[model samples]
Target chain A: MAFIQFLKPKNALEEGGRTAAPIQQDAGEPEKTCPNCHKPIPLSRLWSSYLVCPCGYHFRMNARQRITMIADKGSFLELFAGIVSDNPLQFPGYTEKLETVQNISGEAEAVVCGTAEIGGRKCCLFVMDPGFMMGSMGSAVGEKITALFEYAMQKRLPVVGFTVSGGARMQEGLLSLMQMAKTSAAVKRHSDAGLLYIAVFTDPATGGVTASFAMEADILLAEPGATIGFAGARVIEQTTKKALPKEFQKAEFVLQHGFVDTLAPRSTQKQLLTRLLNAH
Target chain B: MNQIPYAVVKLARDSQRPTGLDYIQNIFADFIELHGDRRYADDPAIVGGLARLQDRYVTVIAMEKGHTAKQRSCRNFGAPHPEGYRKALRLMKQAEKFGRPVICFVDTSGASCGIGAEERGQGQAIAENLMELSTLCVPVISILIGEGGSGGALALAVADRVWMLSNAVYSVISPEGCASILWKDSKKAEEAAACLKLTAGDALRLGIIERILPETELGEKPFYDRIRRALAEELEALEKDPDLVPKRYDRFRRIGQVKERT
Candidate 1:
């Protein structure tokens, strides 16, 4: 039956005799479908627009891609590249999973931390990579972020972070949860030193990360339509056994609820950050 | 005694287990229940107030999962809302202002995961606690009397000294949640519990907690008495240290420390 279906005519017509257009598959330059507008956007056009769709949908960007977009050309010096999570609890299959994720994501941990120049203003920056197990906060991620905040405090530099995570890494168990407290304390020290910290919540920032440094910023900014909450929506739905609002946990909803200071769209984020940095 | 990890989790979550109010009532004197987060309504899940710990007056906050079914329902099964965290933070800050040591009893399955909680900013509420508790001027001690469930528990557990009951289990996610996520079967929670290393012994070995109080008497007067003496002694020692904030920072700082694998 599958072979018969596979052998069906490639030009099958709809009710109006209109054939579906084949997805554009130019080698190394495919198209991405925007989740918001449901439009196929050329990858190059999306890249040129900093991965923002024409319809204002913000695509999830990798940590390096975000660094490139926000940091000044040739000014991003990555730090803590050697820091990676070991299977501290020796949780079953965690070692193999970490190795696989590292190979695929090309990053040692969920977070990429460093010093960078934003429009000629120097600041410590950390960007979480969603590709790396949804940017879970494990021991290594917590340690690196703590080290970054401490370093920022020493240098008396402002810290700007972009967070995207599924929360603390469950594979690492309690150790991963401890990272939330560890990073938050470091952030507190940096904050106590009278340095500014701005956090940019991107895509989905939920669970442990949201309950820690993601929400500990001096000035909190979130990308438009991002999901920012402590608990997952599905879990909430299951626990409450009720239908959720359409905009529940969205960036707009969070702003309406007065949690986020503002929503910065990707196109104007760099300028907004630069302005904020200068003002502080 | 070696117990099955899942069995320990069950023991930690046993409804017959003494709730937060039990400790506040048994361990301290002249308990005056303070109310409200000031910015919002009072959350029953978290009960906070001023009390006398031996000779010193202190502030106590606890996540209360009432023993009776009706009480549990009233307390939202100890799942705190954003206001609960805010209330805890307000009390802690008040303790700092009065130079009083702060003590917390954490026994939550996690923060409330509901629409109202999200709407009221649960994440922001917990985040503020973690940040403020890190540098609160007064000495703070948090004890996991029962379940130490993720961020909700950490919001209250970021203290100068964090201790746990021997049976209490703490983890990033519940064993059932972890099992479902990892193996796509919630029934495998037993295996997940084993892998998580969430037992108090594991936490002590991993250096996530300072000490584990044995549950030999299991909520008898002696158990409370032992905790009270520990608290009184620890607070006395902590009060003399001028480096409370820095030491607390270092305490959490060293947890989960990993060397760069060059």
Candidate 2:
């Protein structure tokens, strides 16, 4: 009950921050521009708006920020934090990349798994951090996600996952790919128990992650303009030699095509999710 | 191993190529076909069920593209719908529960990308298969008998041991697919084929496949003989391993090694 206090209006959006700042260019990089409209967007406004542009272009959000937006105040108890990748393939420079991403993202792996309450309904929450190697599913991430689903089944609580991944981590090679299988199976077990599983897909959910648990949700919600698909648009276009619809692979497109249940914005996602969970 | 040429791609796609059903019929005994995903109507694209392989009872799952135009349309040209994948998963889980090994034959161009399939959770169905098959307690084997395109093939390819028929090709996407996407020209599929390195030889060298069953070119019997021998040897070795689950896990864990650029 006390966790509801964390849903402060101020924290969700910066106070009049959108019109206050102008765009700034980082050294050695092009000006931060919205890919949709080619309009420059200030970095601060980008972060404050959870990376959604004025043009409705959806930028990726980190796992921590996503959890903050959805979970009740101080209700998240992280599980499987000890799980770390061993770089089983000994793939070149993989260990170094893992170390670098871990240090930068403050996450042991691509996914953060834990238990949290949504609208007073205790549920298992797992969020994929696109900042961490594009939220790729590797051994550790897969293991943690599987653990989260299994744990949810044991507790008889529903599960909610927010996915934003580039796909399976290719560095771990096929082992990384196997996570799609492991995590999917976990979802199956959770579903077999008649527990609800909701997936909130964010910008750029592709590859194996899109193929697995990300698509297996009882209720699939997506942020506006988020990219969700199995193959890259470029690949699809090249293969078919045809111009795809403008909305192809976008969140709204997915919803229109019946792949998603609802198109929920980041700001009101918590309330929407709460209502869904309570009704369930 | 490098890029596969266009001719090789055509060779793999040859209509005379033995389909998954052909292999199942040649190798297994007392095969019984199972139907429906139980959640939806039966999808004719994928055929799977219980079968006796040598002395062991195993679940045999195969993607069937069909032979004639009518048959191909009936089977969706070997492209599986969500129910097809669900049926495969149902059969696979049943095999696991019964302590039977699972053998999958992949020959699909890919999963059906139709609007109906998408609406019914085609991605979820494939994802479920990958997840369930990954850690199943029993031995699991996958053989690429023909085209193994994209996630459709991958849905069935995550096994303890993955083998390829000499003419088979496995890729993240089809050469035509890659060509169209990368070059914006479908005719450049030849160039895309070379870059994809999807042929059995390349797959073996890249560690994507465990082994390749060499083509006899003589006829169906010789080709089947090579597949049977390879499958028997691998299954025997896998069946004997006490740490089968972890060992199977480890086998997949080691694929995709790259040399560090100095």
Candidate 3:
């Protein structure tokens, strides 16, 4: 029960009793401008708010930060950290780019997978890193996710994933494309076993990922204002030669279109996920 | 002969090359064209139906890029919309019920990118196809007749056996698309093509495809005949296997396997 203290707060008081803190930014403190409200928010305030602005704008969070936010403290046991991408095709500049991204993102691959407890409920979890090549799915990402699902099926545990990808890693060529089928088949196997799988789409879950595991979940959730679509908006606009509707490809739009089950804002996502897991 | 990757790409996308409908018309007999996704309007880009593969009934689906300009427009240049994928899925499910083998001919630049396609959930459609096709009780054989573009091509290609035409090219993104994104110049497409390893030979080497159908007398009666015979023989062998679904899963499962880089 001691681990319960690390759980996300359900109310203002539980949030370190810091709800009464002034929203106004102090002069000379580092701040970030909110894209939605166009207001400067202090870095400390944003961190305290889970990187969400008071205007309800959800800023992109990296995989590690997300794991910390969603998983119980000390409960995340990482699996498949040794699996890293190799340029099997020997695509020019890909090796250099991967090395640079690995150093900058401090991640071996775009996706991090492991077992963890959410609100005391055990599950297999994967969170895609936006910092790592925009969280592209290549061989390593596919292999790790497939292995995780296979493991979860054997353990009879639910699987939760947060997806944010630019789609398949083009540097890996068709092998990248094949990952979609590989992961989808694994998901099918886990699903056929009657295990639970929930997918949470973060900003920009598009391309091959959108067409594969991102949409194959039993419960599909999206964060507010997340860009979730099969094709890039610019490409669609250029192809159709028409103006996109307001908020096109946003999570809200996807919900209206009946693709996503619900829109879970940052604040309520943990609780909603826990409740869903417990319900099943 | 080892043609340049870009040349293979051009050959695959050549307007004069035989398209999906051509293969269906030439290889199978008693072809009956089915229409519509039943959830929405029918998409001409993908044509699916029942046909006989030399004495046995099979469900045939293809991404038809019409030879003529008018036909191309009608087929949306073989780029399927969400409805097209749904229709293909519907036909596949029908095949499963009747215990007929499914044969798909994939030739698309990619899935259609437009307002309506997204509105109708293109990603969901493709994802559904991938999941369903993996576990489809009946054997599925997908032949890459031309361009196998990304998820669009993959939607119909989760099969027990996937074969590619010798000149066909399959890639995550078109070389031009890849070049524009990576090098910030589409003029680097030739270089990108070489680096992408999208040729049929590269696919065979990677084990992404099981066989490469030679293009000798390509688009001629003999070429079609050869493919027909291959399909019939392969289907006969596949129909005898009890582990079709699991083996299909493992076929894709073993692809991209790499050792842990400790």
lDDT of 3 by residue, A1-280 (tens): 0000011222221221112233343577866667677777887888998988898988778788899999999999999899999999988877888877777677899899999999999999999987777788889999999999999999999999999887898888888899999999999999999999999999878998999998999999999999899988877877789999989999999999999999999999999999999999
Best candidate per lDDT, number? 3
- Stretches of candidate 3 exceeding 4 Å from the true structure: A1-26, B1-3, B257-259
A148-216, model 2: which lDDT tens digit per residue? 988999999999999977666654544555566667767877887899999999877776788988988
Ranking by lDDT: 3, 1, 2
**Chain A TM-score for each candidate, in the given order?**
0.90, 0.85, 0.90
lDDT of 2 at A263: 91
DockQ of each: 0.54, 0.21, 0.56
Candidate 3 pairs with clashing backbones: none
- Residue B230 of model 3 has an lDDT of 96
- TM-score of every model versus the real structure: 0.94, 0.69, 0.94
lDDT of 1 by residue, B216-259 (tens): 99889999999999999999999999999899888888888455
DockQ preference between candidates 1 and 3, better one: 3
Candidate 1's TM-score reads: 0.94
| Lowest lDDT block of 10, candidate 1 chain A | A1-10
Better of 2 and 3 by TM-score: 3
Candidate 2 segments whose C-alpha is farther than 4 A from its true place: A1-22, A25-57, A90-96, A103-106, B1-17, B28-61, B64-103, B108-122, B131-141, B146-150, B157-262
TM-score of 3: 0.94
Query: Scored by Cα lDDT, where does model 3 land?
Result: 0.89
